[model samples]
Target: MNAFSLRRVGLALLAPAIAVVVSVIVTTIVIAAVGSSPGDFWSAMFSNPLPRIRVNVVNQTAMIYTSAVAAAIGFRMGLFNIGLEGQYLMASFAAASFAGAAYVGGFLNVGLSLLIAIAVGAAWAGIAGILRTTRGVSEVISTIMLNAIALTLVGYLVDRYGVHEGNTVRTTKIAAGDMVKGFTPYQARDGQVWALAIIAVLVGVGFWVLLNKTRFGFDLRASGQSESAALASGVNPKRMILVSMMLSGGVAGLIWMPALFGSAGSYGTSFQFGLGFLGIAVALLGRNSPIGMLFGAVLFAYLSAQSNTLTFSTDISPSIVQITQGVAVLAVVISYEVVRRWRARLEQRVVSRELAGAMGATA
Candidate 1:
């Protein structure tokens, strides 16, 4: 890259780097206040002795990356898809019910279930989009309300039709043969990484291409940056909004698949929650690029795997990572906005200088 390109890249990286440093400082402070040795904490956090933890980190990264990509889709179109939590929960439940029904066998089961998930997620998110495009409803409000409705709807479905083995009610269990097969990463002992992780990588690549390498991407981005300009350019902003939401929801549908195929086996009351919200933070921190999102996912995943070990190996609290994450999100948000404003000012100065010189020469 040229000098200007390198400068822009550095500027893009500065905010996330600052956020990470601040989060680290804040996390160390919390650890110190909790009477833990910072040295021991750092040592325990980075020393990945068990191959299993490393595999878990990779698996977790795959899941988190999926969530980030889903969130990023709506973000690119200036839509805040807060309904991701509801969309994924509803999708996973539907997929579990379908796959567990054993209407088909082997690869067909996985394929059909995947389609069901993507469709359900898109349809669920489409509700908000339709409301927005036709009724002038704000997506933020509709999505939040939809989340509540999804929770209630899923609860009712589970209570009425869910298979009960004991006190718990869940969808029927997927057969062992129908489950997605895992492979041994680096041929590690006792490490079987989920095959769905490959799908996650594909999602990221597709997202990148969709945003950067297509006419639809250009129009979507134009619509995102300025609806009026996009309209003047003959791009339908409403259609873009609806499509973006559905697309985001479709990807959100896959967020739970890794966990489902990896270990969860069935959708239950204890299925993972807060992933949608987590995606928002990841998207914000890694706002600029898909690769940045990967780094963010890996960072959080490493903390997750390593910190859990710390709780058992030492007196340090694993929840410290949560504190750090919370702080990091806030820092990232502030830092990025600041950087944006700074860039705008610098651009303004350049434009102003050029205009002044042009006026002088004309005179």
Candidate 2:
């Protein structure tokens, strides 16, 4: 990379670095306040690379990375798509219901279910887009409202259609052979690294290519950076908003697949929640880079996995991980503004010097 590229990369990483340092300091204070030896907590956090733990991290990374991308797409387009939680929930429900209802073999079941999820997610997101474009409704408001609606709607749908087995209501049971299977060399007592991990890798690669290498991506980004400038450059701002929002929701749809296909095999009240909101933090931590997003996801997942061991083995509260996550996200947001202003100031100085030099030469 050139000097400029290197500097940009440095700036990109700076926010996450600040988050890590600040979180550690805060966590140390918390541990000390709790009368626990910080070293013991820290030791357990890094020492375990057990096969099962690794598998859990991989699965968590897959879901979080996909969610990060879903949020990042909207962020790149300057759209706050807070509706990812709703979109993914509806998508997962549809995917589960479809897969359970139909047994079209292996890959066909997976493929059709995926398409259904993408479509449902995109459609749900498009409602906010439509409102934004036609009625001037703020996406933040619309998405939040939609999330509430989705939760309520899902509860009704579940009660009306879901199969009740004892206390838990889940979708129809998928065939054991039909569901995607994960493998492990270490032979975990239960659960393997999700085979759907490949899908997360694919999403990251495709995300890079679409945003960096395609004209549509360019238009969407330009629109985000400045709508007036994008219009002048012949990119329609409204179209970009609608399309980007839907695209974001489409990717968000994939967040549940790793767990659904590789583990849960059905959607129910027990399904994961809050991943959508978490995606926003992960996206900010990622700085819109696929590798950065993956790193952030893995870091968060590792922290969770490590925290699990702490509850069973020590007096330390597992809730410390939650505090670390909150602090890291807050620190990242603060550092991002600092970096932005720093870059702007540097640009202004360079411009002023260039103008002064030109005037001197003319004189």
Candidate 3:
């Protein structure tokens, strides 16, 4: 790339880099204040951030990325999508229930389950969208209520109709034909790498393409940036709201696949939750870019994975990770906005200078 392009890329990276540095410094200070050596904390924190040192880093990172992308979708449309927690949970239950009821083996099973999940998520989010567009309800309030409703609904379904194999309260295990194929990342270890990681990568790619390469993306972004401008430009604001929410919800549905198809092979009372709220934080850290989200998700995942090891290795509270994350998100938000303003000023200066030089030449 040319110098201008390189400079722009550097400018884009500056905020995230600063956020990471600040978070590390803050975390180290917190650890030291708690009577631990910063050196020891760093050593332990970095000791196993990778797959060789740890087994599920990549898989978990992918799941975080999926969640981030889900939130990012609504973010790009200027929507908070706070109900993603509900959307994913409800979708997971629906997918699992349907998958259990259907005996179709192989790719079809996985496909159908995923399809059901996507549909349920979209439909759930659509409720908020419809309310927002038609009745002028604030999405924040509606989604929060929807989340409560979703949890209550899922709890009821699991209690009343969940499959019980002996004592476990889980949906029937998806047949091998329906389950994602697992592979060992390292030859020596027996742990199976989550096959859903592939799907996560695809989700990121698709998100990028949808937002950056399509006309619909333009309209979506325009609406996010200024709904009035988009409406003036022949974009239907109401339709965009509905479509974007559904799209966001559809992607949110995939947040549990890593655990479902790869780890659990069934939905249960014990399945993972809360990824939707985590996704909001991840999206903020990433600034809603696919590439940024990948890095942000991995970093967050590394911290999350470290929480377990940190507990065993030191006297430090594992909640330190949460503090670090909150600090990082706050730093990124504040620093990035400042950087963006600075960059905008710099670009304006360059444009004015070029125009002045042209006028001088003409004179």
Top candidate on TM-score is 2
RMSD of every prediction: 2.7, 2.6, 2.5
lDDT-superior candidate, 1 or 3: 1
List pairs with backbone clashes in candidate 2.
none
On a 0 to 1 TM-score scale, where does candidate 2 land against the true structure?
0.91
Q: Write the per-residue lDDT of candidate 2 for residues 225-253, one digit (tens) a residue.
A: 99999999888899999999999999998
Give the per-residue lDDT of model 3 (tens digit) for 102-180: 6677778788889989999999999999999999999999999999999998888787887766676777777766777
Off by over 4 Å in 3: 1-10, 48-53, 164-168, 187-190, 351-363
What is the lDDT, from 0 to 100, of the residue 243 in candidate 1?
94
lDDT of 1 at 332: 92
Give me the runs in candidate 1 sitting further than 4 Å from their true place: 1-9, 186-189, 344-363
lDDT over C-alpha atoms for residue 351 of model 3: 85
Query: Where does model 2 exceed 4 Å of error?
Result: 1-14, 343-363
lDDT of 3: 0.85
TM-scores, all candidates, are 0.91, 0.91, 0.91
lDDT of 1 by residue, 276-354 (tens): 8878778877873699888888887787778877878888878887887889888999988888887778667767987
What is candidate 1's local distance difference test score?
Answer: 0.87
lDDT (CA) per prediction: 0.87, 0.88, 0.85
